[model samples]
Target chain A: MATAVNFKSEESQAELIQLVSFNLDREEYGVYVLKVREIIRMSNVTRVPNTPYYVEGVINLRGKVIPIISLRKKFSLSEKENDKQTRIIVMDVDGELMGFIVDSVSEVIRVSAGEIQPPPSVVNGGVDQEYLSGVINRADRLLVLLDLERVFSQSERESLINSSL
Target chain B: MAILCEDEELLEGFLAETSELLEKLDDDLVALEKAPEEIELLNGIFRSIHTVKGASSFLGFDLLVKITHKTEDVLNRLRKDELKVTPEIMDVVLEAVDHIKLLVNDIRNGEIVERELDEIINKLIPYISDAFRESAVLHMESAGTSEREKEVPASPVQTELETEAAAPAQERPRIEAAPAPSPQPPKPNSSKTVARGEELSDNTTVRIDVKRLDDLMNQVGEIVLERNRILQMNQDYLARENTANFGEEFSKLAKRIDFVTSELQMQVLKIRMIPVEKVFKKFPRIVRNLSRDLGKEVDLEINGEETELDRSVVDEIGDPLIHLIRNALDHGVEDPEERVAAGKPRTGKVVLSATHEGNNIIISIKDDGKGIDPEKLARKALDKGLVTEDQIAGMSGKEILDLIFLPGFSTKEKATDVSGRGVGMDVVKTNIRKLNGIIEIRSEVGKGSEFILKLPLTLAIIQSLLVDVENEVYSIPLAAVLETLKVDTSSFHVVGGQEVLKLRDSVLPLLRLQKLFGVQGSETSLNQSYVVIIGVAEKRMGLIVSRLLGQQEVAIKSLGKYLADAPGIAGSTILGDGRVALIVDPAGIIEMEESGVTGAWAA
Candidate 1:
């Protein structure tokens, strides 16, 4: 929401933007906590019959059937066996509850406005420019705050409705 | 609630009730033309219009009330046997009904129709038997219950109306519903009729928010799934473990839960079931005006108006059905003189009936008129470049009839404003297919055409036949599945680089699921494997799958924005084991094949 963006762009250190951070390959990425509904251990994901390679499948989160997207495959990152550290961070993408398979979820941290800066197109870890929102320059490492909306745009959601038709 | 809010609420209630009553009134008034002395039908018509007037006056729709009052005057005179139900009088009443519908619709949409009601009121005046006839009957009708008017003086206006028409007469405490600036409304006028009176109980049914009922259905779905999961877990443990007594008790408990959960689910689904009468009611008037416009005569016989369907289906099926009826009146049914010269009944019969066929609802519109001439349709198809002569040579009679559904292929040489614009049947086909329904056409050149539509019982949940193509499970909605086959390898032959399976004498196009979805699977499964024969209308395809997972009732859920437009995938469903499976849209698969990369199925 704009509130989270406002917190990032504001001057007050007291106003902090909360983000849930996770790993794709090596580098860390963060999405606003508001977009992250929940994070759970990866469970049984029945493969959808016909979909893009990156679309791992879908998982039943409680009773709702949610399609899952694999970040590793989507961003052309190296793949590895899913270990105990793997977590499916369920995010509300345009009101649909979709799960994102991340390496693991780290601690939820709050960063002030001045800490965030526009992302550079060529990141050292080689992440796609479209999915990056801004770089949160944390003291330990550069945290890339992802733009969930741009990653899954309105056009995609419209296709979901059209596909179901 | 605020005063204005309460007024709007009451206004909403009144509009819903009146519009429904008006819809039924349209059919009753037309029926009265044939059997003019059917007093009960006349009473039904008069009471409907009277109720609308009374409610409109109370709700302060002065214009609407006045128009309906004029309409009621004519209808009331007809009821008193002082007026004849002539075609001209029927036109005026039907016109008034249309106008009231307009005003009511506008009012329902929160717009006060500013157009003067003088034209309709004036049109109704000539039809009124005695323009100066004392409204003594309506006034005297109110005298039937002066006792109730005395009992409930809180809303003297409504109390006065309770006697004016078909009010229940026995008012018990008034219910005091719908927020009160008007203290309470009079029982909301019983918007729905009691379906049967054979087994009479208290017979009280409460109005519930449709959203609440939908929510209840979803929750019931959740409970059913949860129960299935528990039963599966217990049965597996019992089979594997050495706990004998625990197994006995657990099996018994699972059986009980299964029975209760299924009952709960069925009851919840039934709550959303509404008779298709609401959709059928407006047709008589529609046919009336249509026949009048074209100078034709049509006798619309409606059967099985009481066939119940899920409310969601009822809401959507109305438009498509209307267009089909229009088609029948325009193209299918012959003009009155033409019918007589053809040695047929003077009044063409258009039978609109709904019947429950197993899990699906089959609504057929059968017309006794000139059936479609395939040669003409084939020539039209050729002229429109919709099909080649070579394609026509290979087509069957049904395929030629099916050409009407092809876009831009209307057979009418002279385009009429009624139904021959060439866009309706295609739209009808598309809309019906959108509801996961099928539209079938059957006709003989001399005999009439019947447009049979098979629609699902509900939209949210569907019984799906789940299949596996290489370990990946896909669901084919049971509605679209024609049948299943374990076709031998010899039945499938390569024809011009495309696989065609000979199902007896007919050649069915073969769609390999793994190739369609681009799923990586063993091609060997195609040999002597399970094939789901799915069809929409005349286009049938055999979908090859690895395993048949049996049938399961799945609640359809949309894939969130990311994977929304996956071709051949309709929506996803959560299986009993809490794993997600994509619901195969058979219609979508056919559309994709036709529109995109055709013959790309060659692996």
Candidate 2:
């Protein structure tokens, strides 16, 4: 919803936007702050059989069952070990709550909507361009704004799983 | 229109009350068709229509008021015996009831598509049995009348209706309770047949939205889990050596909390239950219409209508029950002449009954008309290519009968709108399966046929036996678990290259859960293992597990939309230890077993 608002606001001026950025396999990916419900430490995840390989399984979120996915596995990046900084970012994707496992959490960053450019044709971080809403060029490092909706879409997961099979 | 627009609540209240009254009216109307001389039924029908008329008139729903007002006049004449009950008269009355239903529904959706009320009113006018010219004059005289005159005082039946209606609604337990002072002989259940005998009338019910109950159930589920966790913690605390004296007090408190929570959960589950009569009531009307249309003499006897089921199940079980009843009437029951020729009674019997079996509800639809022929069903399946010659040759009689549930396998040569297009049975099977229920067929070639459906009483919470495979736990609903036993590896023998366990008198197919779920880490205890035997319909399979976690009351939680269709996994639930365990879908695993997914064993 915040992304939709940002996109609409782009017509008049470059509105400032907030993103909850995190690290996945050394690549900085940011999701709109409004989409992020919370960040919590990694907990026990019960593996569910016969799901997509990237699905890390499910966790009990305050008596609710929430599916957790491995962003590294999802992006086809080299898997990394969970450390002190590992966190699960619970976000709202198309009205359903799903959690994504990331290497570490980063500080909230503000970037002008105009500063975020269209995803380049050849991205080097192994994240698909379609999943990237835009690339943000911060002074210290490159930040990729993620379109969590597209990344976690039903058809996208189904097609990916089917192709892998 | 202006009044309804100004007070939508009044219109809504009218719609709700009228719809319920209309449903009861359907059943009463059908029963009246069978016993046309029941005065109490006539009076009750008249009062219900009069109530609808009163409410609609108050709401200024002019069209509804006009139609129901006319219906009331016709019913009043019937009540007074001024008009006789005949098929043509019943048809017109039922048709008017149907139009009232449409108008109520249209009002509900905020659009009225101008039905021809004049035609039905004119049709009902002839049944008034009074001089039409005189009645017209009376109607004109009553025009612009006060509310009291329009509502209750005008009709002669009103005075008697008021006295009876004011005699406490609590005297009625069953909506279609046998008429008071019934002229028929006493039924076996004397309590039910004895009408209006109770003095206590304090039980008043409030109408609640189902969603509110669902939310409350979820909250109670959370409370149950929290209580379980606290109890587990207290046990851990008591197990330690260094414990304060308060620990005993704490443990007692936890125990009390546990008992209270369990009671609370049970009560909430009870609140979610609705008597199966909500669905059963509609069937009499359906069977009546179908039998009349087919010109067959069939009697629908409903038993165990008071069986209570979780509301969700009751809501879904209606359609399948309807279809099965239709199937019984349309195909199972023979024509009156055919039955007479076959040396059977002219009035074929179709029994729709429900009964509680342990923790499950078993609803059976049985017909005494004509039983399904296994060979005939097999021939139909073969013709449809639903099964091959080899398949049919290998199947038993029950399996052959089961072929009717296969898609596109119908015995009827031509599709009839009344349940013979071959499309319904399979859908029925799917729907029952979705409710975690199993449907079975019991038939004799010449005697009769019965379709029995066994369903869990509640979907939200169930008693499940949790088992472990490679330290990963799974919960199998105890309703499906017939028994659990510790068996030696050597006792298992291979039959036709599939693992089979000889348990007592029967050979049970063995499915190793470790192999089916592909749980990582090899099994270290290879000698003795636990086998949880589960069955649906007539097929049973013994699931081999490493350790038994005993029985638990588990609240079923979905795997969410992302992993909703996990194969062999029914759902997920949180254990007392706060870890998630998958609930095994025994039916799905049974299907897999049929599909030849039995993993290879080294034994």
Candidate 3:
């Protein structure tokens, strides 16, 4: 997922997609670097009662209260206790600032858009196909670019809740 | 290029000044109709028009200058006792004022105003004497020649025509070329204009861009957060102190920081305070025009124009207030003949007023017209198939009265231009709800109906008392919270599977935080739990939480569009301890409290 951004002259001519890669469970996922406002170490996230299971709760980033969702829980991966490596990536998704908890934020990398391709029909980690945008090869390993917008889309949540009701 | 830049700046100032003057002129002109002998108000109307004319002529807005001059002639005649104030003449003056307003608006868009001015001028010229008319013609001729045109004065909030007339014309314009000309041609009648113009200003104030004030407010908010972080760090220091003296010094400094930040927040909020008169000023013109058009004689009285609200609230609330006023006139007030037949006064009375009650501002529009008959409303609802006959039968008079707010509910069979298609009241409700406000209607048959719009003082930041519900923290706006106390669970009566507590004489319905938010947790029996008693207008309810946290000032942040309509959650705010807490919606809670007003409904 690459959001539009103004870049330096060198990068201007290049079809580069900058992403912040993070480790969730055993998989490495990348989201548009422009979407990430900041990355903070996992801190006290007050549990918000009566929210979806994946919404770990909210945390205070400066004076702004932003909702935090666990990426592992969101993807339905097995839940694990927070470790020293855990980081909360604060992002602005369509103007709403939110935080996503991941095992660790690896590095920010710029990859060519031409290298990235659409995902296969079924993928690893038991993640829903609708949340997957594409997969790309970085070095020798495969880097999964997550569609954060679709992952946290409201329509999907409502439909899920509607079916349960 | 410099001239172009200067012109843009001058035009911006001109628009702001003219609009403000026109708003006040509207009130004064409407008031003149009621008390034709109030010479101060007549002069007030005259001076405002004169001020507009002077500024427009200086700006080379020849069309606006010409129009206001003619309007000024009519007003001057009325001021000179050369003409009498009649309904027809008052209408002519108001119509001229209306055209002037249109011209100012047109000039604001950088377009030359070319309205049908000759017809309006012909109507106004009858009120002007020959000598005054000839002097006006001479002034217009000289206005075109640069040699005769004086150097335009530096922008003043209210410029007088006499000062413009007195300026020394310079062939070449220079920055700060001349000091303001002394008030000129001091005629005795001119003194009256002076007397009227300066009466409205007792305290000197500067007009500031609202955006700049908002930026300052936001910076102050950031300072508060920084202070909180400092306090938190100081607390950490106090917790593990190696040297007591050092800890004491740090604590004192932190406390000082806290005090200064609190004072600064107050100062910032005070600057954002705007008088409610900005909104109220436009209503008299609306009422006058509306009553005249509807063939109903209405006496619209406005009071408490001095009450202040937050700048943002003042900007938003005008249209909703206008809609309610229109509804009051169209439906609530009846025709003069109908009033006479009903043994009421021939002229209907509508009182629009504003007054602060505690932290909230209560603006009520009350009309002494044909009061809303609940029976007729019920019949209308039935005809519209909005409610079943049995449901209508079971409803109380207040409940039936509320049906007017329901969508697709219009009292008038024929749609009028004022409030068309019955969509206004529902939209009014939604708009007030957006501002965290409430609109309540009270009516008596054959009497008038009163629409009370209760609103918060400020929407951006509010002092909230944060509380813990299980593991989650939620904030209750301090303005809505009446008191917090522990109540025995045994005192709760489970009526029809819904829980309510009897607090002294009143039976208070209780909404348990866990149940309201649908928290997935098991219930535990306790002797007592902390309950925050909250009030929205006249309704009160108890919110049961696990613990009561201390109060803090919260800068409201929107939860975005997807969650905007979420029930019970107004917004989210960050706490001093670096944790996010949801700000509960008291209005929405009250709505839930009212709708599920019945025991089973609550369940």
Candidate 4:
């Protein structure tokens, strides 16, 4: 019988962290492994009323409504240039399965928990540190770990809810 | 090993469960207004609040957890008959639900928000006993009431005792029982005491984003265009082949391609089909607020909430429908005293219903109010110089009612915030025309008025009657084409220096596409000419074209920024041979024709 590898368990036991990594433009970013729900191919998303610019819109994921956010736009990147490899990463944040559009998802990396360091304050001239949970150096690549909850301000989040109402 | 990891997934399961519980809470609240005595309803609402409070506290959303905890206390009291479900109590609870919805929205937006729930919690405190308010730690510890509180006014204390009383009497052996002799008021309804009766069953439904469906539609359109191109090519090839085997193969290929393309189109169209419930849901709240504000007794009855419409149409229809409903209440429905004086019921009725008829959905807003007075409308039109005295004398009642749709025309003496600020029915007409829909109004003085709006089921794919003027092909939406006829050239005569067609005693203005599009005239006169009668905003006109082409389902592709504002053209579509065919905006053309503009020449 083929066994399903318990990566989360092994990582915790070995004091290693599993990161769900994806590519944005040319840079690599990783979120905690537990945040990710699954990876799905691009599907139809219905535009919702009164959403913010970065929110591409909401989609019906197997009968459950989930909003899709364009990470590129969220980070103030230029408008998307659609390519074959463009994908949406479905992640469960606070129980909501939100799909964030990205260039493509890379492999999950296992790094010792001790290897993760606090994010640099002035990486590339004052990067937005609110979104950065931590940073891990893996070989030649610097993986910027994201704290997804910090992406929105309190008032802005309230406005989003008001618009939905 | 896997069991430990699966604990992470438990949070997601809890979220799904909590959201479902919240939805039930909302539906039950709305239902409680109609059936307040259903104890099961109160218990169901209490359980949902309890579950949310439990999960929120566990998840460390302190503010949400706190508010839900307070709300649960109030609900517990209400369930035990300690507090009546008064209007004030309902308001506070609904406000709490609104706050919870806001919190959910915040979480959805990826914010760890600590909201100020003090105001809502304070409002709810009046419903709870003073003991529950004094000590937060005590409230958390004592989940059950003391046996001495049995005679207390139906408080959260009594509810806990009741639940304990249902359990084995030995379970409370340590409690003092001297207060059990206190007299209690008999409950009004025996059936309202049971807890499980009011819980509403979960009806799971999903909300979809419309953009995905639009993208799918665009892809299907391209496939249909490709299929048409291939079929056209096959036709040319098959015409030259005399062999039976070649003909059979070509036909088979064509059949398969046709089947696939049609199915693909239908599936894509299905995604755009959303029930009218989204639009209808807001109306109940609107009517409630409006009736309260106006101090009028009005009941809003909505039927056919399940009617499906294209998502695009549904979005656009909301504003217009709101305006129409407000108009019906303000102008059509008289005040209670006025209604009673007029021999009508003291409470006015506004019925908003939608029904699917053939390929169109007919939505009617009928109100039993003071119907529109055509005489007053005619007088206003004449006063505003919109119509001459002679025109009023010759006009019918329906024609006079339509005059209200004229820009800057309103019979109301003073402008109010709701309806009459002089931005009259013209906007409604313009918006309906933009959707390629029609609106008709019927009224009888002292009786009532009804506004009927007819809209196509889907705007993505439309069957268009293709016609040619000079050398260019233009598509007239089949919905607007009333009829086509072959008219003798002699039937046309110059009226006011413009050609007019006289058909059966009705003089309809004739618009030629060659002249409309700035295409040079051919200089050759044909005795027989094709005339397509098209309707725009309730007015019908004859469109004189050179030839009539067969109808086909054309996928509407928007003309990019440069040509979007061009008059007389709605959008462009791709033909079988990859040629772009401009679809005629009949309403725009009719407006241009009425405005006496011959053509729009590029600068």
Choose the strongest candidate by DockQ. 2
Q: Is candidate 2 or 4 superior in lDDT?
A: 2
User: Candidate 4, residues B248-325: lDDT per residue as tens digits?
Assistant: 766777787677677777766766677786676667656755776777878888999889888878867877888889
**Model 3, B80-145: lDDT tens per residue?**
898989888888888887788777655544455356676777677667777555544455445446
Better of 1 and 3 by DockQ: 1
RMSD of 2: 8.0
Q: Write the per-residue lDDT of candidate 2 for residues B69-160, one digit (tens) a residue.
A: 67888887787777788878888998888888877766655666666666776777778656553554465456545434443444555446
Residue-level lDDT of model 1, residues B528-548, one tens digit each, is 868899987546788888889
Ranking by TM-score: 2, 1, 3, 4
Off by over 4 Å in 2: A1-12, A157-165, B1-5, B110-243, B488-509, B523-525, B592-603
Q: Which numbered prediction scores highest in lDDT against the true structure?
A: 2
Error of 1 at A46 (Å): 3.0
lDDT score, candidate 1, position A103: 93
Model 1 misplaced regions, further than 4 Å: A1-5, A8-14, A120-130, A156-165, B1-16, B77-83, B110-115, B125-244, B525-527, B561-564, B596-598, B601-603
Model 3, residue B150: distance off in Å is 20
Model 1 DockQ reads 0.52
TM-score per candidate for chain A alone: 0.86, 0.90, 0.86, 0.82
> Can you give the DockQ of every candidate in the order shown?
0.52, 0.60, 0.38, 0.02
Candidate 2 displacement at residue B14 in angstroms: 2.4
RMSD of 1: 7.6
Identify the candidate with maximal TM-score: 2
Q: Encode model 4's per-residue lDDT on A1-165: one tens digit a residue.
A: 001123323454457778888888677888777878888777665432224567765555654456678888888766667677788888775555778898888898987766667778766522366787678887799888876755644554555544322
Residue A50's lDDT within candidate 1 is 47
Judged by whole-model lDDT over C-alpha atoms, candidate 1 comes out at 0.74
